[model samples]
Target: MSRMNRFLYSLADGLKGILRNLMMSLMSFSMLIGSLLVVGSLSLLVVNIDAIIQDLGDQNEIMVYVHEEYDDSEFNQISQAIMEAEHVVGFTFVSRETALEEMKNDLEEYASILEGMEQDNPLRDGFRIQVDDPANVEAVVTAMEGVDGIGNVEARTDVVESFLKTRNAVNLISIGLMVLLAGISTFIIMNTIKMSAYTRREEIAIMRMVGATKGTIRLSFVTEAMIICLCGSIVSFFAIMFLYQELIEKAFSSTGLLQAVPFQEVWGGVLLIFVGASLVIGVLGSLLSINKYLKV
Candidate 1:
């Protein structure tokens, strides 16, 4: 038979093999989906945590308060000094009037009690300074303390340090879990393929006697494993996306407490990873399992 004909025959036989051993095929399919789900869920969690950390870093800023006695020229000098400071990416001046107005808005229910306090506004003008890196916030605060006309400098270094620690811990744990699950999944798949080949040993022997090439026999089994894995990957991808959407709607969309990374931004990478992993596991497992049978 021609090589093309042999390939087509093998492919058809592979489909038949799945139906012939439906129960085992189903077991393999379920295990693949389960493994994918666990890994994918953890991946999503890590992505969201990373997003939250980034947002917090962006929001973190050093507050530099100016003494109430500084004139406009001194304020301009202070601004110039801040702009020249190392690690200072940006700074916005908040006038005492603006600060008082913001406080009034925040205390809307008690606005009447503070209606006449504008003339005697006790708020101080300040600069909200953005650092290029959160780790350098303390350095920037220290530099600002020596600047003339600056009364106080405040920063939340402890909060940033805590967040960094949490991110590291989460990443280490997620990576360990993913590796463990992947190893278990691969082992299960390898054994399942081996058992399937064992059940068809008689047929394989007959094919060998009839001059069927080892390549053809191997392709048939590999194709069968690939088909099962592909189906499981497709199902798991959709199921994961569905669950993510549900989570976004129920937990994040209405409450506005936490933001989720949009599926639109990540689905392509997730699909590619799932499909690639499935193909690798399928091909590797089939090759390893069928090699023993083909040795005869």
Candidate 2:
């Protein structure tokens, strides 16, 4: 028989063996799903949140201020110099009128304090420059200094740095949790598979005496493990979909942090994690358990 056929036949036979212990298999599958859901959910949450944070960081562009009395020719020269900078991604000019409008929108509480001060608007007009990377912000800032018509460059360095630090800390904690949960999941699945093997020890011995190859025996157990794991993964996916839509989406949309987190992207990431986790747990646990039985 072809290798493919052999694999299918072995898998089919394994399914039959598992079916003979239907109640036990169902119970094991349930446990696998629960363990994987815990691990996969946390992994998905971390990855999605990290992506959102990165998007926010990417939008952290530098705002370069210009002197109020600076000439138009000097302003154009400075704009051109910023555009030609090595690390410059994009630059947008905020005219005096635009700056005043922005200030008005932000400071509605102090409307009376500046209700009629059109000519007294002290905010400087400037170019908002975006760099290729947050790390290269200092390079961009240094390049902007002393450029004609530019008063000073402000990068919001402290705020962006704090955001990066928080992102890294969150990612680190999530990674630690994922590793711990993965270890626990492997332990549980292995024990469950071992129990299955123990329960079928006599049957396995009988098959061995009847000239069953180790490959066949191993494949059968592995098939059982795969089934259990796949079922658990499917359950976790639906559960996450429901929870994400009903709980996370509904709650966050009301608060307007919804745009900060893209729902579909997060869902896709979570689905991948859930499926990948299921496969790893199912295959690894089966291999470990079947190897022990093969020695006997």
Candidate 3:
């Protein structure tokens, strides 16, 4: 037979094998879908948590208040010192006059009550400093405190630290769960293929007696397993996406307390992961079963 004809014949045999062992195949399919859903859900959770942490970091900044006695040249020196500080990406100086004006505008309903306070502005001159990374904010704050003429330095160190800790904990937990699920899925798939091979032992033996090559036998079994896994992966992908969109609409959209990373931004990568994992698991499971049960 021609190579193309042989390939087609093997694929046909694979489909027959699946039908011949419909119950076993369905069990494997169901287990695979469940595993993929759990893995995908964990992955999405980690992705959204990382996104939230990044947004928080971007919005965080340090406020450095300078002594009221400092004149323009002294303030200029202080600004220069702040810019030169470690982890300081940039800084903007806000004079007491500008601060008072901003306060009045923010409290517009009571603007008249503060109309005569410009000459005795209670606000102090300060710099709003941006750091290179949220993780380094404490370092930047420490560096700011050491700068001459700077009276006080303020930062949201507690919030940043809490977010960082949460990110690390989620990553570790996700990794552990994925590994456990993959192992369980692989084991169940292996047993399903093994049972299929055992049921067709007579047929496999006859083919071997007729001079069938080991590769040909292996291909049919591998193809059968892969087809099963591929179906599960595709179904799981769409199911998770639908459930994720529903969650975003019903829960995340109505609240400003939490924000989710859009599914569109991550679906491509998630699909690739699912498909790739399915193929690998399918091949691995089939080979192990065939080698031990059929001795192919």
Score each candidate by Cα lDDT: 0.85, 0.74, 0.86
* Clash count for each candidate, listed in order shown: 0, 0, 0
| Shift in Å, residue 180, candidate 2 | 2.4
Question: Model 2 shows how many backbone clashes?
Answer: 0
Model 2 residue 117 lDDT score = 65
lDDT of 1 at 291: 83
Across 1-296, the per-residue lDDT of candidate 2 in tens digits comes to 67788688767866775777677677667766676666665565556556655665588688898887877788779878998997898989998789888888889998777676687777788998888766577778888885877897888777656656766776787678667766666666677677778877887888788888887777767777787777778887888677767776677578876442555767677777777877887788778767777765
How does residue 34 of candidate 3 score in lDDT? Answer: 92
Better of 2 and 3 by TM-score: 3
Candidate 2: C-alpha RMSD after superposition: 3.5
Off by over 4 Å in 1: 1-3, 71-77, 85-87, 132-149, 156-164, 206-214
Clash pairs, model 3 backbone: none
Alpha-carbon shift of residue 170 in model 1 (angstroms): 3.0
TM-score of each: 0.84, 0.80, 0.90
